[model samples]
Target chain A: MDDFVYLKNVVTLELNQEKCNGCGMCLKVCPHEVFGLKGGRAHILNRDNCMECGACSLNCPMQAIFVKSGVGCAAGILNGILNNTEPSCGCSGNQSACC
Target chain B: MTTFKNPEKAHSPYILDFVPTPAGEVPRVTGKLKLRDVLGTFMVRWSVNRDNYRVSPGLYAIGDPTDSSDVFVTANYKLSFDHLRKSIDGLNAWILVLDTSGINVWCAAGKGTFGTKELVNRIRMCRLEDVISHRRIIVPQLGAVGISAYQVRDRTTPAATATLTAGSAGSTKPLKLSFNGLKVSGGFNVVFGPVKAEDIKAFIRNNYHATREMRRVTFTFSERARLIPVDFVYGKYKLLIAFALFFVLSGLTRKGVSFQLALEEGPYAVLNILMAYVAGIVITPMALPYLPGRSFAFKGFVSGTVAFVLTLLINFPGLNFPEMFAWFLIMCSISSFTAMNFTGSSTYTSLSGVKKEMKVAIPIQLISTIAGLVFFIIGRLF
Candidate 1:
């Protein structure tokens, strides 16, 4: 029922349907239910739902997905911009300086 | 005999000459060493000397450092050493490397492996007291948690400790160095920058397995996959229960309702449930930023109110004042409950904030949902 909508148009993921095997891996891994099964193939039903975690590509056996993943948090991104360093969501691989 | 490299040729503004040991006494290893480039930019390499197995992770005097040479401290991990050395183009500082289980300073400090005890031990092992005349040793600022300036001073005889920024160690300006130290006042102030965002995006993109777990719709899948006999049995059970509940409630309330009346009540109950579900999960996250107030509960209330109005318009296009007024209450209750459930995902809401919101929001949501369901059932039955 919340009327406020997020306006940020950051594209966090892409699906190459040509390479998709309809394995439903992306559907299962996405926290936002961004992908759904259609015609026996996976389709991005809601790309805006993506948080850009990049889990689908890692778990994809066929490598049919690609995304520019990082911490989607604004504060973390701002810090990265100010320091001239790469921004991280502090959950990529345990190398996080901030939890 | 090892010859002294000219101090003038190796002079750098960032590098200083500390006390030096006797020329022959200093251990020297010479060879064309090959280093593996790990993690893209960081290089991990080893040097071999006859009868000495040096496979990285140790302190070494690179080139010839004279007395008063700048003593720079670093992790024994070859990658850390490489990063430090690569930045110093012409500096001939004495590298004091500490064994950190082959991990970087920030992570090592977190794990407590690069703590105060280890730093003190490493200084003693290197005979830094005798090699450096100046009582000062420079450490990385990130390693401050594991090291206590007070503890290091009390433990070591005359050696004082100073923390430096990792990237700015090469800067020649004293003002810049001072500013770097002052800038990183706490763990949050440490410069993670865009690397954090990049890493988060990369993690989400690569780890599809986690996404799969999140998107599994248990309720819908159960409804779709169950076979005929089970579905038939469930249907019969539902009918029998509905009939029994209707008569029981009617008798208890001193009011009688026909079977058709009860059937009419069922559809509105289902719609309210559907609207609640959509508002809670779908609408909240999609429109998180523009919610009317900073408080998540307030935002949810606003969203719920909007949804209620939209539903009224769509469902009863030609309804009169009385009909519309009656439906408004039901719609408001359903939407409010849905929006209130959105406290889970919002970023600004802290744990305490969530707990507080839930305490008030939950009772109201439960009361409204139950009341709306009752009204829906009664309105249909009558």
Candidate 2:
């Protein structure tokens, strides 16, 4: 967070406060501190900081968080383009890894 | 006590002997980190203690686990176990360490190692029915991807009669369904209650409660720090490995020279490869956030040019302008390749963004490196 400023507003990580129990599952799993607990519920402090890893969404018990997570690496993309495959980084799916 | 990497696999025959805990009773132990554990944690980060980095996967007791002792599940990556154990200061719990190929919960969950299937199977194989009185199995929140709370709840302790209906797969169905047909005769309930440790115990103890049922999870800075090493390895090591390979191959491929003469010229080849390493591996990452430019390719070029200039000024003063320019192009191109690879490790880049960057970046980098290589070879021959 010290020097890293990502491509802004890309992470569609949204949280429904009414459903959020603020169990802090999202807080623990998020690498970028995207969600913070305010009073009794969870709040998205910085939407831009999200890398779309979907870790928060996966960890959220209430199903209150959402993100269009996927592989953001270069070679994976280049390989996908060269091979004409829709390269998935496992961000959108829950079953496999992005690799 | 039991030790099996995969719950689906047979319990290692020696598991009982390996651990002193009684069968069906995982001992409760605080996951306190001693000096050795601290050392292993650091060693695992750098990947030096590869063998020493993992704990045996199976059922473990933190202190002396009883039927009522809490069960905290984690991966066999010893660092994860160590941290979890350490985090529980006064709590007595049975730790069910999963065989995640020595990866932590966050990573293993992504790969499906720390999922519902493993949890349900492990619970049955360990005879958790006899060990814990509670029907609940507390898993890390991050492991939710690999595990469906509904599946785990359905398939937990009593396995022979496990039934997972197709209706349960979709979110539209009832979130929590109780099947009377799958109920046991003794009224013994086996449910996959994947509760957070922090929510269950830590938050209550620390008075981390709101007016209602808000249970807080204590996420320490130290625990969060573990994720950094993987990212560091991903960012730094690729170009370093490439540099080493290039150095060895370039030293061997020199023509009209004895092997010894080629060996004698190894330093030049090393320096040439070193340029790419310095620019891509060292400077670019160290100054990543500050490296001016939206494009990583441009950032790498800038860093590579700096590396080329520094090496040229210090080591190769006799080079002509053409030779210097050729070397610059080569270094910049190689550096660009290395930098572009860092896109995955960066938070800034996305799938669409990287796809766009690569279509333009890769061709330019390839052309510059190739042309520079040709010019440098001609410069050397003339």
Candidate 3:
């Protein structure tokens, strides 16, 4: 079922190859298998499946993953915009850390 | 964290007796919905019933399971478990609940909580090999995001297509999965079957046959409902505070001096905040599909404009030039701000696009709100 792909360039996931120690943590932690290890480095195999959940960034010990987290939920962003605060997941469902 | 008033009472009319498995002892259900179950379902759906909804992670017997029971896997999320149990009212099946940290199957699958590794782990933990005569699992269709059927064989990176038909005799050959895109032809995905208790047998039977048509799979009602809370009841706690702030601040001077009361200039204060809410929270989102904007911030701007006209007609019949100008800035910006917030909530919104829009939109919203607040104070005083 690997041929499946969602919309592209939506997720802000970035991998710093120089900083990556090939720990393979991103591959393991990612639910959608967005990353794959090649030549002892993490490669983004699929970009579209990334839901911007930020599990990889938190799990990445070397800080190799750079994603501006907490911008995924509209309700959170709405609250942030109206209340003048940072936006994140506002709904109780579909969550892990930030919006 | 709201607890169920009665945790032990069975909600499904079926009396659950203890059924022993290698993993642990579990309650065997008769597939009846209990009164408390109905209450719990509503409470949880509305965000009142908190944590107690979760069923323990283990194998559960439905309608008196045997070694031949078809093993259906799901998350420990109460709703997911409940759906499975409630659907099998008169049938015999085994439910294996995974530890998804209290998330439903479809969502947990995307999060990788309901994954192949965990699937293998649960299989081993339950010694499922011994319990079931035939080795097969019916995974939900949406779970393909996290699980590769090829992963079950411990093979290398899967090819896009691989065929292995079971029972090669006649037209009734064993079904095999063929993934072309989002749709799987001759596959083994059981999507809630969009089915209920009465149709359990047919749903199970349908999964066993190979079909070339994409007839079975479509966006189900329950699926869409998961994303949209039609009530707009979210963020109530914050709204209450904002309402109070508007009521109090509108009656006072910028320097905290007051000879004026809220009821006197109530229309000005109440209308401004209300217009903002309608523009952002109500209009932008409710009309999201019809709105003619690609960017959420742009949509918000449109909603804000609509709010301004409505507010003008309702509250300020003879609004002066400055009053019109100030209200435009404040009220429209409020609507615009809320519409932008909807970007984060929308599934279709792209993260990169939103970040870019925020840089420009946020500054404008801030400037407009500040300018509006200042003009409003000036208008009230002078």
Give me the candidate number with maximum TM-score: 2
Candidate 2 lDDT at B156 equals 54
Per DockQ, the best of the predicted structures is 2
Candidate 3 residue pairs in backbone clash: A73-B344, A73-B345, A74-B344, A74-B345, A78-B341, A89-A99, B11-B34, B12-B32, B12-B34, B166-B174
Q: For chain B alone, what TM-score does every candidate structure achieve against the true structure? A: 0.34, 0.67, 0.72
- B1-382, model 2: which lDDT tens digit per residue? 4643456334422123223443543433445456766776676565455433566766876655566666777887776677677666567667787877666675566557877678777776787766665554566655554555544654552333333232545333223334433322211332222234334354435443221222222223443244335334543455467555444433343463345634665466568766775577456766776789767777888999888878887658656665567778888887887777666545445555566567788889888878886765565544
- List the candidate numbers ranked by TM-score, top first: 2, 3, 1
Alpha carbon lDDT at B90, candidate 3: 73
Q: Candidates' DockQ values?
A: 0.03, 0.24, 0.11
Superposed by TM-score, candidate 2 places the C-alpha of residue B72 at a distance from the truth, in angstroms, of: 2.4
Docking class of 2: acceptable
lDDT per model, in order?
A: 0.45, 0.59, 0.60
Candidate 2 runs further than 4 Å off: A1-3, A9-46, A56-68, A75-99, B4-23, B27-53, B134-138, B144-266, B294-298, B343-353
> For candidate 1, lDDT tens digit of each residue in A1-99?
022223234454678888888877566445456688888788888665554555466546577888765433432343455677765322223222221
lDDT by residue (A1-99, candidate 3, tens digit) is 132233457678899988989977566445455788999999888776665656567556677997664445445554567879775343335322111
Q: Better model by lDDT, 1 or 3? A: 3
Better of 1 and 2 by lDDT: 2
Give the per-residue lDDT of model 3 (tens digit) for B89-173: 6778887777776766645655577776776667666666556554556655444434545354342212332333445534443
Query: How far is each candidate from the true structure, as Cα RMSD in Å?
Result: 22.8, 7.9, 10.5
